[model samples]
Structure formats: C-alpha cells, structure tokens
Target chain A: EDQVTQSPEALRLQEGESSSLNCSYTVSGLRGLFWYRQDPGKGPEFLFTLYSAGEEKEKERLKATLTKKESFLHITAPKPEDSATYLCAVQAYHSGGGADGLTFGKGTHLIIQP
Target chain B: GAGVSQTPSNKVTEKGKYVELRCDPISGHTALYWYRQSLGQGPEFLIYFQGTGAADDSGLPNDRFFAVRPEGSVSTLKIQRTERGDSAVYLCASSLDSNNEQFFGPGTRLTVL
Candidate 1:
C-alpha cells in the first residue's frame, strides 16, 4: 500500500516568517507527487506536481521540492492569508497502468499570524 | 473555465437513511474522482472514473458506498445505510486525462446523525 506522512502536524508562524513543511512517502512505483493548500471548511486547492527526484515547482511564495522518498513545501515570507492546511498526496502506477487515485497524508495545519 | 462543482454543499441524514451527492466535472474532462475527508485529515480516495465507466474502486470502504458516472459527465455518489462513521466531507475532482492535474470541488459536508 502507498503511504504518506507529514510532519509538524500543526505549525504557527508570524507574518513574513518562512519555513518548510515535510511530506514523506512510500509507494510501489511513484507516478506523481502533489501538494495542495486547504482552508477551513474548504476543499484543497492545487499547488504543484513533482514527477521525479530533484524536480521542483514554484508558485508565488510556495516552492515544492521532490526527492525519491519525500517532498518538501517551502513557504517564503508568508503573509497572514497564507495560513492553511498543506496536503501531500502521491499517485502510484497500478496494475492498470493508468492514473490511479491519490493516497494522502494527514496534512500540516499552518497558521500565519499578522 | 469553471472548475469541478458539487451540489448540496451540506447534507444531514439519519442512520439507516440513503443519500446521494452529485459532482459535475470540468468541461472536456474525461477523468473524475471521489474522495472523503474526515476532520483534521486529508482527502482519502474513494473511486475514480474514466469517461462513463469506473476505472478504479479499490479505495471504496465497502459495498455500501457506490458511485456512477453516466453520460460521461455528471456523476453521483450513493451511500446506503449511512452511519455516523460515514460523516465526512465528500470531495469530487476532475482531470483532463490520466496524467493531468486534478481540480477539486468545494465538497459536500455530510453529517450522519
């Protein structure tokens, strides 16, 4: 079974503080790794998709880096509005050889205070 | 373009009752997925469809949870004999194909009393 684990279950940071959230995973054959941002009572919003080791993607103040066994979501100079839960998911190549559903972690609750 | 949309933003049901949640995927999207997210947790995969047929249903918890995507567009998830343990936010997502990014809907918050 594919599994994902995220660290710092809950994090609190002041505005402009930068930090990185961690996501570790173990899959039979990784097809894709994704990062999403979710707010209270809202669905997750897509962030980045890293396909291989050493791959990275950036959007605004968030940068996602991928390794063979884990992925990292780095937030730089975050603002109050950046507060949200960060989710990590992985899709593995299945017997069908097509796209399969994702296996997600518990997520990291990030609170950015102004 | 409009993202995925789910109906009945919230649903309240009693144990042993049946409920149905709907999802309308993005136009031209051929792949749709269903997930469940409990309190303080990330979304858990339930099922996914490719076109009008279910491509995978391994993540479904049991036979009580079933979904259908007919006409290759709109989909509905049906729950039978709902239980308190079934209470969670049901999320729907869509993608262009097998190797594309999935866009998620706002989700339907289900409360089984």
Candidate 2:
C-alpha cells in the first residue's frame, strides 16, 4: 500500500519565526505531490503541487519542495493567520485498479503566536 | 464561481439510522470524489465519480455505503445502518479532470450516537 508519514505532529512558533514541516512517502510510481492547509472544521485549501524532484513552488511565506522520497513545506516569517494544519498527499503515476484517489499523511498542526 | 458545496453542515443521528449527504461540485468539473475524515486524521478516500458514472468505488467501506451522481452535477452519499464507528466528517471534492488538483468542500460533520 502507498503510505505517507509526516514528522513533527505539532508545532508552535512566534510571529515572523521560520520553520519547516516534513512529509515522507512510499509509492509505486509518483505522479504528483500536493500540499494543503486546513483550518478547524473546514476543508483543506490547496497550496502547491510538486511533480518532480528538484522542483519548488512558493506562495507568500509558504514554500514547498519535492524530493524522490519526501517533501518539505517551509514556512518563512509566518504570521498568526498562517496557523493551520498542513497536509501532504501523493498520487501515483498509474491509477492502479483505476483508483485515482490520493494518499494523504496525518498532517502537521501549526500554531503561530503573535 | 462557487467552489464545491455540501449540504447539512452538521448531522446528528441515532445509531442504526440512515442518512444521506449531498455534494455540489464546482462548475465545469467532471471529476468528483468522496472521503471520510476522523478527528486528528486526514481524509480517507471513499469513492470517485467521473461525469455521471462512478469510475471508482473501491474505497467504499461496504455495501451499506452508496453514492450517485445523476445528470453529472450533484451527488448524494447514502449510508445505511449507521454505527458509532461511522461518525466522521464526510468530505466532497472535485477536479477539472482526473489529472487536476481536487478542490474540497467544507464537509458534513456526522455524529452517530
């Protein structure tokens, strides 16, 4: 089975502080990796999609990088509004058995104190 | 344009009762998905529909769970003989195509006591 593991189950940071969250995965063949931010009782909001190793994407203070075995979400100078649970998911290259659903990690909860 | 939307934001029902959750996908999105999420966990895929046909239903836990997307616009998820273990937030998502990113709805929080 395809599996995804995220490190640092929870994190606390002060305003303007920087930190990085890790997501490791094992899939048969990688089609894409995705990052999403979710607030309490709400759906996950899309962040970035990294398709290959050495590729990086950024949005505001959030940056996402991909590697063969893992992905990293780097938060730079974060603010209180940035506090949310970050999720990582992977879609395999072939929809084996015709199941194209994504496999997601447990997610990392982030709290930013102003 | 509106994003994916789910009805009955919160549903509290007694055990063994049947419930139906609805999903309205974004305009022009042909691919739809259903997932269930428990507290402190990420969403787990339940099913996927392409247009009016269910391309994949492998994630459905059992035969008691069923979904339909008639006319290829709105979909409904039906659960029978609900058990306490079935309580969770049911999420609905949609993508432009199988290869696009899936955008999610707010989710329907279900509680079976």
Candidate 3:
C-alpha cells in the first residue's frame, strides 16, 4: 500500500527560527513529491515539487529536498507569515500516464510566534 | 490570471439532505481534482477529471458521492444522504496537466447537523 507520513505533528517556533519538517513515503512507483502551505480557512498553496532523489527546490525562506524514501522541507529564518500547515503528497505512477490522485500526509502544523 | 475558485464558502445542511459544491478551475487547466479534508487532517482525494471525462473515480468513498466536469472547465461535487461523517471542507484543484503542480481553491466548509 502507498502511504505518506509526516513527523512532528505540531511545531512552535519563535520568529526567525530555522526548522525542518519531514515527509516519508512508501509507494509502488514514486512519480513526484509535492509540498503545500495551507492557511486557516484557505486552500493549500503550491510550494514545491521534487521528482527525483537528490533533487531540491527553494522559494523565499522555504527549501524542499527529496531522497529515495523521504523528503524534507527546510525553513530558513521563518517569519510569522510563514506559519501554516505544511502538506506533503506523493504521486504514484500507474499503468496509464500517471496516478490520478495524490496520497497526502497528515501535514505538519507550524506556528511561528512573533 | 485568477486562481481556482469555489462557491458557497460555507454550507450547513441537515443529515440526510443532499448538497452540491461547485469548483471553477483556472482557465486552460486540463486536470481537475476534488478532495475532502476533516478538521486537523490532510485532504483525502475524491476524484479526478481530465477534460470532460473522469479519469479516475477510485478515491470516491461510495456511490453517494458523484462529480462531473461536463464541459472540461467547471466541476461540481454532489453528495447524497449526507451524514455527520460527511461534514468537512471540500477542496478543488486544477493543473495544466496531471503531473503539474495543482492550484487549489479556497474550499467549501460543509457542516451536517
């Protein structure tokens, strides 16, 4: 079975603190890994997509790195505005094209205190 | 261009009632998806549509749930005989293609009384 797990369910950090969130997965065929940031009452915003091991992507204060069995979202000097639930999902390639749906992780709730 | 948009930001319906939520994907997007998220939980995939055809409906929980994207643009999710367990936020997303990054809508918060 394909499963995605995210550790540190909840994290509280002071403004300007640096931290990392983890996402581990077990899938038949890993096609792509995605990261999203969701604010209260709003939909998730796309952050990054990592397709292969040893790949990394960055935006602003966030950086995403991928490995064979897991991925990491590293936050550098995170501000209060960076506080949100970070979601991780994996796409498993099926017979036709790619997998239709994404298997999502439980998400890591991040709170940045100013 | 504008991002994905959903209608009825919030809806409160009684148990056993039927409800429909709407989604307007970004213009020119070829792939649309539906997901359900309970409080404090991750969004669970419900369905995906490629153009006017449903590419995959395997994630749908049961026959009570149905979705359509007749014109390959806007989509709607219908739930029959709603139960308390059905109360959650329904999210809609769209992408240029199945493998591309998805742009999500604000989502509809449904409450069953």
Candidate 4:
C-alpha cells in the first residue's frame, strides 16, 4: 500500500529557533515530492519540489531535502510569519492511468512564538 | 498575474440540497484539479482535468460528486443530494502542465447542516 506519513503532528518554536519536519512515504514508484505552507482559512502555497533522492531545494528560510524513503523540511531562524501547516505530498510514477494527483500526508502544524 | 480563484469562499447549506462550487484556473494552465480537505487533514484529490477532458475521476468518492471543465479553463464541481459527511473545504488548483507544480486557490469551505 502506498502511503505518506508525517511525524510530530505539531511543533512549537520560539523566534530564531530552528527546527525540521519529517515526511516519510511508501510508494511503488516515486515521481515527485512537494512541500507547501498553508495558513488558516486559506489555500496552500507552493514551496519546493524534489524529484530524486539526495536532491534538495531551498527558499527563504526553508530548505527541503529528499532521500529514498523520506524527506525533511528544515526551517532556519523562523518567525511568527513563518508559522503555518506544512504539507508534504508525493506523486507516484505511472499511477495506473496517465492522470496522477498528489498523495498528501496529514501535515505538521508549526507555531512560532515571539 | 492572478492565481487560481474559487467562488463562494464559504457555503452553508442543508443536507439534500444541491451545490455548485466554481474554480477559475490561471491563464494558460491546461491542467486543473479538485480536492477535498477535512479539518486538520491534507487535501485529497477528487478529480483531474486536462484540456476540457477528465483525465481521471477515480477519486470522486461516489456518483453524487461530479466535475466538469468544458473549456479547460474554468471548472465546476457539483454535489447532488449532499450529506453532512460531504462538508469540507473544496480546493481548486492548476498547473502549467500535468507534471508541474500546482497553484491553489483560497478554497471554498462547505458546511452541510
């Protein structure tokens, strides 16, 4: 069974404190892994996409790295504005038909205190 | 310049009523999708459309849920005889292509009473 699981469902970080979120997935064939930040009452905002193991991408204060079975999102010197639900999703290669939608994990709710 | 957009930011309706949620994708985006998100959960795929055709509808859950994208740019998700279980935040997203990163809309929060 293909599944995506994220650990540490919730996390609290003081301003300037750094942390990392974990996302592990099991799938027949890996296609792409994506990270998104979502705020309450709004939609998810795109963050990064990792295509292969050992690949990494960074934006602003966030960095995402991928391995064979898991991915990590590292937050550096976070601020209150950086507090949001971080979502991780995987798209399987050759998902039965030509169409494939992302399989998402529950997500990690991060709160940054000032 | 504009991102994806969904209409009726919040909808509250009684069970058994029919509802229509609309989505307008980004200009020139050929791939559009619909997803449902319950409270505290990630978005789940409902349907996918590519250039006016439904490439996949396997995730529609049941016959009561249907989506259409006639022109490939604007799409609508229709729910018939809705139930309280149908309550969720319906999200719409579009990508430059099928394998690209998708941009999401603000989403429509549906509350069935």
Candidate 5:
C-alpha cells in the first residue's frame, strides 16, 4: 500500500530559528511530491511540487527538496507568522490518466514562539 | 484571479440529517477535488471531477457520500444519514488540469451533533 509519513509530529521553535521537516513515502510509482502550509481553520496552501530526485524549489523563507524516497521542507529564520501545519503529499502514477488525488501525511504542527 | 471557494464556512447539524456542501472552482479550471480532514489528521481524498465527469470517486468513504459537478465548474457534496463520525472539515480544490497544482478553498467545517 502507498503511504506517507512525516517525522517530528510537532515542533516548537523560537523566532529566527531554522529547521527542516521530513516526509517519507513508499508508493507504487512516484509522480510528484507536494508541500503545503495550512493555518488553523483554513485549507492547505500550496508550497512546492518536486517531481524527481535532487529537485528543489523555494519561495520566501521556505525551501523544498526531494529524493528518491523522501522530501524535506526547510524553513529559514522562521517567524511566528510562518507557524502552521506543514503537509506533504504524493501523487502516484497509475494506468488511469495519473491519479489526481493526493495521499497526505498526518502533517507536522510547527510553532514559532516569538 | 480568484481562488476556489466553498459555501457554509461552518455547518452544525444533527445526526441522521442531510447536508450539502458546495464548491466553486476557479474560472477555467477543469479539475475539481473534494477532501475530508478530521481533527489532528491530514486531508483525505474523497472525490475528483474532471470537467463534467467524475474521474474518480474511489476515495469516497461510502455510498452515503456523493458529489456532483454537473456544469464542470460548481460542485456539491451531499451526505445522507450523517453520523457523528462524519464531523470533519470538507475541503474543495481545483486545478487547471488533473496533473497540475491544485488551489484549495477555505473549507467547510461540518459538525454533526
């Protein structure tokens, strides 16, 4: 079965602290890996999409990197506003026009204390 | 451009009642998706619609949960005999295409009492 797991279910970091969140997956055929940031009572906001190993993407203070079996989201000098649940999802390649539904991890609840 | 939108930001209903959650995708988006997120858990896939057709409904939990996108832009998720277990946030997303990045809505919080 295809599954995605994120480590450090919860993390508390001080303002200006830099850290990384991990997402590991075991899927039949990996099509893409996605990163999202979700605030409480809101839907997830898209961050990045990594399609292959060694791929990297960045926006603002957040960066996402991908490997064969895992992906990492690195936050540089995170601020209190950046605090939210970071989610990782995978798209599996199937015979039926590529499955669009994403299998998401439980997500990492991040708190940046000021 | 405006992102996806969902109606009834919060819905509190009694068990055994029926409810409908609506989603309006971005203009020109051909693919729309529905997901459910329970407390402390990630969003789980529920259904996907490509244009006017439902490309995938395998993620739907059971027959009681149904979705429709008759016009390919606006969609509705209907639930019958709602149970307490059905209490969760219903999220709607849309993409230009099935394989592209999806834009999500604010989500509708459904609470079954």
Candidate 6:
C-alpha cells in the first residue's frame, strides 16, 4: 500500500530559526512529490514539486529536497509569517489508469514564535 | 486571474439531510479534484475528474458521497444521508492536466448537527 508519513507532528521555532520537516513514503511507482503550506482557514498554497531522487527546488526561504525513500523541506531563517502547516503529498504513476489524486501526509504544524 | 473557487464557504446542515458543494476550477484547467479534510488532519482525496469524466472515484469513502462534473470546468460534490462524521472542510483543486501542480480553493466548511 502507498503511504506517506510526516514526522515531528508539531514544531515550535523561534523567529529566524532554521529547521527541517521530514516526509517519508512508500509508493508503488513514484511519480511526483509535492509540498504545500496551508494557513488557518485558507487553502494550501503550492510550494514545490520534485519528480526524481536527488532533485531539489527552492522558493524564497524554503527549499525542498527529494530522495528515494524520503523528502525534506528545509526552512531558512523563518519568520512568524512563515508559520503554517506544511503538507507533503505523493502521486503514484498508475499507467493506463487515468489521473491519480495525491496521497497526503498528516502534515507538520509549525509555529514561529517571535 | 482567479484561482479555484468553492461556493458557500460555510454550510450547516442537519444529519440525514443532503448537501451539495460546488467547485469552479481555474480557467482552461483539464483536471479537477475534491478532497475532505477533518480538523487537524491532512486533506483526503475524494474524487478526480478529467474533463467531464470521472477518472478516479475510489477515494470516496462510501456510496453516499458522489461528485459530478458535467461541463468539465465546474464540479459538484453531493452527500446523501449526511452524518455527524461528515462534518469537515471540503476542498476543491484543479491542475493544468493532472500532471501539474494543483491550485486549491479556500474550501467549504460543512457542519452537521
């Protein structure tokens, strides 16, 4: 069965602190891995998509790296505004089965205390 | 341009009733999706539509949950015999063609009493 597990269920970081969140997965065929940031009462905003192992993507103060068994979302000098639930999702490559929706992890609740 | 949009924003319904939540995908998007998220958990996939056809509906928990996309641009998720457990945020998202990143809507918070 394809499953995604995100560790460190909750993290409290002081402003300007650097930290990383983890997403480990077991999938039949790895298609793509996605990261999203969701704020309270708002929809998740797309962060990055990594398609292959050793691939990495960055946006502003956030960087995402992927591996064969796991992925990491590294935050650099995060500010209070950067506090939000970071979500990780995986999409399996199901050939001839049409489009597949994402299998999401429980998400990591991040808090940046100022 | 506007992102994905969902109607009502909030819905309060009683148990055993029927409710419909709507979603309007981004313009020209060929893929639309529905997800249900309970408090403190990640969003769970409910259905996926490619154009006007349902390519994946296996994520739907039960037969009481149904979704339709007649024109391929707009979709609706209907729940029959609603239960208290059905209370959650119904999120709608769309992608260029399912191989791209999805843009999500603010979602509709459904409350079952």
Model 6 chain A worst lDDT run, 10 consecutive residues: A92-101
Which clashing pairs does model 2 show? Answer: none
A60-81: candidate 3 lDDT, tens digit per residue:
9999999999999999999999
**Candidate 4 structure quality by residue, lDDT tens digits, B25-112:** 9999999999999999999999989899998897899999999998879999999999999999999999998889999999999999
Shift in Å, residue B41, candidate 2:
0.3
Of candidates 5 and 1, the better by DockQ: 1
Better of 1 and 3 by lDDT: 1
Q: Which residue runs of candidate 1 sit more than 4 Å off their true CA positions?
A: none
How do the residues A1-114 of candidate 4 rate in per-residue lDDT, one tens digit apiece?
568999789999999999999999998777799999999999999999999999999999999999999999999999999999999999876555453888899999999999
Q: What TM-score does prediction 3 earn?
A: 0.98
Error of 4 at B7 (Å): 0.6
Clash count list over all predictions: 0, 0, 0, 0, 0, 0
Flag regions of model 4 displaced more than 4 Å.
Answer: A95-99
Highest-scoring model, DockQ: 1
Q: Which ten residues in a row have the lowest lDDT in candidate 1 chain B?
A: B95-104
Interface DockQ of each model: 0.89, 0.73, 0.84, 0.82, 0.84, 0.87
* Model 5 alpha-carbon drift over 4 Å, by segment: none
Which of the two, 1 or 6, has more lDDT? 1
Please provide, for model 5 over A1-114, each residue's C-alpha lDDT reduced to its tens digit, 9 standing for 90 to 100.
679999889999999999999999998888889999999989999999999999999999999999999999999999999999999999887569666589999999999999
> Which has the higher lDDT value, candidate number 1 or candidate number 4?
1
B8-88 in candidate 1: lDDT tens per residue? Answer: 999999999999999999999999999999998889999999999999999899999999998999999999999999999
Tell me, what's the RMSD of every candidate? 0.7, 1.2, 0.9, 1.1, 0.9, 0.9
Q: What's the TM-score of each model vs. the native?
A: 0.98, 0.97, 0.98, 0.97, 0.98, 0.98
- Tens-digit lDDT string for candidate 2 (B1-113): 89999999999999999999999999999999999999999999899898999988989999999999998989999999999999999999999987889999999999999
Residue A25 CA displacement from its true place in model 5, Å = 0.5
Which is the better candidate, 3 or 5, if ranked by lDDT?
3
Worst 10 residues of 4 chain B by lDDT: B50-59
C-alpha lDDT score of every prediction, in listed order: 0.95, 0.94, 0.94, 0.93, 0.93, 0.94
Window of ten residues with lowest summed lDDT in model 5 chain B: B94-103
TM-score of chain B of each: 0.99, 0.98, 0.98, 0.99, 0.98, 0.99
Worst 10-residue lDDT window for candidate 1 chain A reads: A91-100
